[model samples]
Target: MGIEPKNLAGWSDLLEQAVKDTLIPSMKTQEYTWDTTDIVSDPKRLAAFVALSSAGESIQVGFSGEPSDVASVVSQMFGFDDLEDAGDDYSEILDGLAEIINIVAGALHRSLSSDGNNLQLSIPLLIHGEIVIQGKEEWVAHRLTIGDNNIDAIIIRGLIQKQKD
Candidate 1:
């Protein structure tokens, strides 16, 4: 079952903190804007998502960008000097994306689940090529722009609430 936060404001602040900590750890935290950019305009765009669940609610955290752009961000995370140094390994890039989501979700889970409400997480799922994400339209989703990477990160809070059967 998904764990729903009784206080939405507090939950949003935590989510924002997770995003800032995960994406901009090196630099000063910047304000994130509502993301409306079309990432799919680039044919090589890719997306990765990780599922997070608590006693009351479940959420998915995702990142979407062109493969090259994502590599650049991942390279930055790994202390690579430049995008070229990160190379064109799709497997590595996707793996890094999953790691990023994992870290962020883990942090959020820890803080919110401290009240004896365990928050569980699933391995991240990467989607590229022709896969269309179904049932996402009904999710309580938000997209935000982080830094200058030109990628949109998606946060989706699930509407279904039930303890895992």
Candidate 2:
């Protein structure tokens, strides 16, 4: 099962802290500041999601933002002096996107698991378009700013699926 609705706020705070503690520094830049914001909108953007599970409970975390902004952060994370140094290929950009999520998710996993939750994480998946929800899972969405980039973070609590006997 997913994290309960009642605990979502606390978990949201943890998630935001994880982002601040992990994502910002990993960008390898000092100009970026992390702060809560409204959900973002960009016609074309880059996104990634990672699934974190513990025993019967699980949640999905996602990060998405405009392509240019994401690419800028990724470039900085890679220590590239400029975007061109990071390459112009789409696949390369996607890989960079996946890498950042992996870093953030891995850190989050370690923190939660340390508290005896024993969380496991799926590989970060690069996605296009919106996150699709097929069940009645409770979720929380938070938008954060990294410098001028507006990135959206989504947490979708898992719903336990029963098996037929």
Candidate 3:
């Protein structure tokens, strides 16, 4: 089994901490602060999703926000005054977003592995549209506000199963 169902909340809390701890201090922009964690839909234009799997169970993490906000984050992460400085290329922006999710997943992976959860992380998937969650799937999403930007981090437990015909 993967993370126990009863321990999901605790894991989610840890995920929140991972995001805050990873971004708060290292970010170039200092005005950004921890806002709140709440259940929210995917309203952002860009998103990156990664998953951790162990013993046939999986936990997926998705980080999403607006393109401008994502660009801001990429700029901050790379120490660029603006993403435009790195060139106005769109693929670089997407890669930067993937890297952000990769960093957060790395942190979470270390924590969970330290606790004896032999988990393997999957490649980060970048999405440009909406994220749809099927019925019976457990989705725990949080809204994190940094400065004036709103980012959503979603945690999905269990594998997605297809309905029978």
Candidate 4:
């Protein structure tokens, strides 16, 4: 199941807090417009697009990077290290990336649903093959910046429905 529209506003607010409390502690926060895009088929892939900038500059923190590095940063915030060391395996690195996305999603879910109701989240699917974001024109991407990254961190939230034949 996906997130409902009525819950998105609260979700976004919670996400902002999660980022500040869990990811970037010294970063400034801002509210941007919320928008949606078409849902992709890949289950490993979470969210539509993510853009995080540090110190007003856009940094390319691709999933191809080291899992240890990612885990280290994330673990520091969450206080638990569930990621396994996979050495130089790219697939393992991708798995770590998916985990990070999941963590972020879970944090959002928790922030939105204060009643402790269960929020269903799809398994983290890898972004493979050809995939195009449908309804790109309808999306309002929000960006937030931290540290020296010139570009702002982006958060895109939208209601996604399955395409009918």
> Mind giving the per-residue lDDT tens digits that candidate 4 earns over 60-88?
11121223444444344355545445444
Number of the top lDDT candidate: 3
TM values, all candidates: 0.70, 0.77, 0.81, 0.44
lDDT of 1 by residue, 129-149 (tens): 432435553332345554665
**Best first by lDDT, ranked:** 3, 2, 1, 4
The per-residue C-alpha lDDT of model 3 at residue 56 equals 81
RMSD of each: 5.9, 5.8, 4.4, 11.0
Compared with the true structure, all predictions reach lDDT values of 0.62, 0.67, 0.72, 0.39
Q: Model 3: residues >4 Å from true position, as ranges?
A: 4-7, 29-44, 84-89, 158-165
Top candidate (TM-score): 3
Cα lDDT tens digits, model 3, 87-133, are 43557777888988888889998888888788899998777656666
For candidate 2, lDDT tens digit of each residue in 76-151?
7787655634544456666787888788878777887676666778887776544555457877777766666667
Error of 2 at 163 (Å): 26
**Steric clash pairs (candidate 3):** none
- Deviation of model 3 at 114, angstroms: 0.8
TM-score of 4: 0.44
> Residue 164 of model 4: what lDDT?
26
